[model samples]
Target: MGEEEQEDEMVTCKTNREKEEKEDDAIATEAAAAAPYCYPTLRFDIPPYRSYHFYQQFRNASNPNNFLKSVNWSPDGSCFLTSSEDNTLRKFNLPDCVDTTQEDTCSSSLEDPYVADLIVNEGESVYDYCWYPYMSASDPTTCVFASTTRDHPIHLWDAITGQLRGTYRAYDAMDEITAAFSTAFNPSGTKIFGGYNKSLRIFDIHRPGRDFEQYSTLQGNKEGQPGIISAIAFCPSHTGMFATGSYSQTTAIYSENNMELLYLLHGQEGGVTHVQFSKDGNFLYTGGRKDPYILCWDIRNTVSIVYKLYRSSELTNQRILFDIEPSGRHLGTGGQVCCIFC
Candidate 1:
């Protein structure tokens, strides 16, 4: 080959090699820059639950029909109760903080929460169950729980004796019984509230047959907002304030004085089935049916969501509910599939 042509060919080859090297370096740099943003992961620094007081089992070999539906702790924190699909409510007593017995039941995972305390089962199927707001083991006579049934009256049962204490009903003048989907007692335990399709009713605890007052859940007929409060919670310290979550995917705060709407908190893609205020009453956590995220909002600043935690994904066939620890150190929900402690 001619010297000039050979020299030109060698130079071209060297230039092409240098171009390929530059392209490779550029590709590597681009990937490094996109790594952190494209696939962001959820991280948490939640404290581990030091001890598991007890695990309440829902089902056993002989009792395979016990599917857990909901659980709630007493106002005094002395005990908690669970409602199951088998149409029964069971209470589990928690050991005192000073218990000398070793808490070998302690676990950080979602093990079968099996416990033995008390059981009250007499209903077709449970729609909702709650402990009386002032329920304390110290007062056995007054320590009771109330539940609503799809085809039965709202029965307030003595938690200690496993006997029916009272029954609240929402009936018409013609004496036709109505269905109650959810029920809760006022903070003072003087009155009971039942939630129906789009209405919330209040009845005197002494006389449970008729509602003293009925209030619609909608605010000024605001279209496409929270409807049919699936859950209701009253602040322990702030008796004048309470919150309700609806099937329309909204959580609302209201004042008890006049039952006036105070502040509305909205950020759920599915119907909110659970809502709870922290011990301090400054923050709230909400989760909904078919939604995997539990959103935490600051009542003081409701402009933006401050934090969020996830449970199972939308594919799961269960409605997930979350609860904060008594110490406020950790958060908990159903299913270990996608639930995080932090």
Candidate 2:
């Protein structure tokens, strides 16, 4: 064959091979893309309860006096912890009850929480309290609870025994110590986060660290009117997702791994004092000092607000308390309201 003719043939062969390769790759890509996606849908089927019919007025002795600031239930849902302006962190225990086996044999019903114990002392005004993770299976029944106070310090106490575990002094360089508003434990229970003033400081709880040996610095809003991050909560399902609310009347969903801002939730009227994720991590609830309403948002759809529970009104402000069951079935709010869903 002539040289030029052979060269042209060779080029044609190469182009055909390339075209075939491209076609094969396109087919493979489409096949992979067409694979069915599977995401577990959270079932929220339990019916809702009206504010009146759900929870009775828990006028138990352990109830915090004045403004009941924060509440946290134990891991097993056997008890609940609360901190209030009344200057105490108390533990209310579930009434003793036999397991299903014994219940079936005896034909008795399950018990409820009562004024079982006083976990913390009566002097310091506890602004927030968080139960330690993995508390149920711990060696002793003395689970840890972090109580942040206007006393310019965070006190870690044994929820069962009421013994002081450790005290984290407020950083002196920050001028006046603001009220420690919100406290939370990392999912692993190795670290604790305290929200105050303009800083969200993380501390090493297990190693017994000094005052606020902060490993991460999170500053939201800006100077002139630095937004005080009033409420902070770690995601219950995914370790990397967390939510923070501030005095600027905004809530930011951020990544815990790199602290990257994911979404900023707004439309509230006042500073957010508390933010929490539903047990399944599908929804977020936020409320605060001036906001007498609990705002619920769908995490997947950032722009959608699921519901709002009016905690107070013009005639007389009603203090609404709230809690979520571990099973994610029941949401108990203040003023005797419990919401249930599948």
Candidate 3:
């Protein structure tokens, strides 16, 4: 073919490619517009009303004092899991017709507006529990959670059927079984990170057994984060980093790739009970046992305490928990007091 003919064909091909690219962009834009992200709006000026109550569900007839210890919502927001003093983990599914905006949407006369759909009785007291990061109600295989209890191996339970899916065991140097103090799934949901006495263990989710990679939080000369690890949290941005809170009143950040200690934070008045990353993963919030303030630290600088959030938990030894909202604007905390602070 002549040179002019070849040039014309090249121009025609370029035009078609541009047209296809424009169509692809239009499709993506339309898809985004159809289901745009929505953030929740919370009002702090008015007193929050109770949307649901569950006094009857948690009450134990025999014990008469069974109460909830901690509560966590599933990753998909479809349900919530609660650990109670009765050595049981209960899963409560949110009702489809319930509306929080209305005062009397559900049965107002009922003492318990919701009941646990499933319950798993642990052999001992539950230390920590976390849902799989990728868990969804639409996917049965991904609908699972991991829990660590006293004198028991880490158990992965099916949220739908309330069955034990698998167990991840850790053995002490004496060849005896050891239980983790806290457990959490990595951001990828491919591995489970367990907190122990001055050490951390990583277990492959696909292989549930005694096999794991252990790393000591203490270095030579015994100068590192010591005491039992109380909590673990991963960065939401997938930065290959995580934070661990210890009973030694210290919180440390470590690299997920090599498990190397990155930074150690001090100034907690009591043993650190919970550590959480902000929605953007640039800051970390930590709450301690008997500590009324939740300290927020700028992970980037780590020079001094950024700010402290006050909660009514100075007199109790319970682990007061706090979490950042999805919008990263407001923070809510639970304490020993009757009221929840936001």
Q: Which numbered prediction scores highest in TM-score against the true structure?
A: 3
For model 1, the stretches where C-alpha displacement exceeds 4 angstroms are 1-65, 94-115, 172-175, 219-226, 336-341
Greater lDDT among 1 and 3 belongs to 3
TM-score for all models, in order of appearance: 0.73, 0.65, 0.86
> How does residue 112 of candidate 2 score in lDDT?
28
- Between candidates 2 and 3, the TM-score winner: 3
In model 1, what are the clashing residue pairs, if there are any? 55-113, 55-114, 56-113, 56-114, 57-113, 57-114
Report RMSD (Å) for each prediction in the order shown.
18.8, 9.5, 4.4
- Model 2, span 1-342: residue lDDT tens: 999999999999999999999999999999988997544444456432211110112333565235555666787677777665557566777557635433232122233223448646655655567778778724554477777766656778876677778876556465644556678887888878787665677777854445564422344443222376767788889668988777877888877676667888886777776677998888998865556577899989988788887754212222334666656655655533344333
Rank list by TM-score: 3, 1, 2
192: Cα error in model 3, Å: 0.7
Model 2 bad stretches (over 4 Å)? 1-71, 97-116, 172-179, 209-226, 304-319, 326-330, 335-342
Judged by lDDT, which candidate is best? 3
Q: Write one digit per residue (lDDT tens) for candidate 3, span 66-161.
A: 988888999999999999999999999988785557676344655677689999999999999999999999999999999999999999999999
Q: Candidate 1 lDDT, tens digit per residue, 1-342?
A: 999999999999999999999999999999998785333333456544345533346666767766767777888888888877777787878755554565544575567444658988765878788877766678776788888887787888888888787777777457787767777888888888787767777888888565568887765766333477778888756657888888888887878888887777778878888888887788888888888788898877888888888777555535567777766556778854735464
Per-residue lDDT for 213 in model 3?
96
Q: Quote the lDDT for 95 in model 1.
A: 53
Evaluate residue 72 in candidate 1 and report its C-alpha lDDT on the 0 to 100 scale.
79
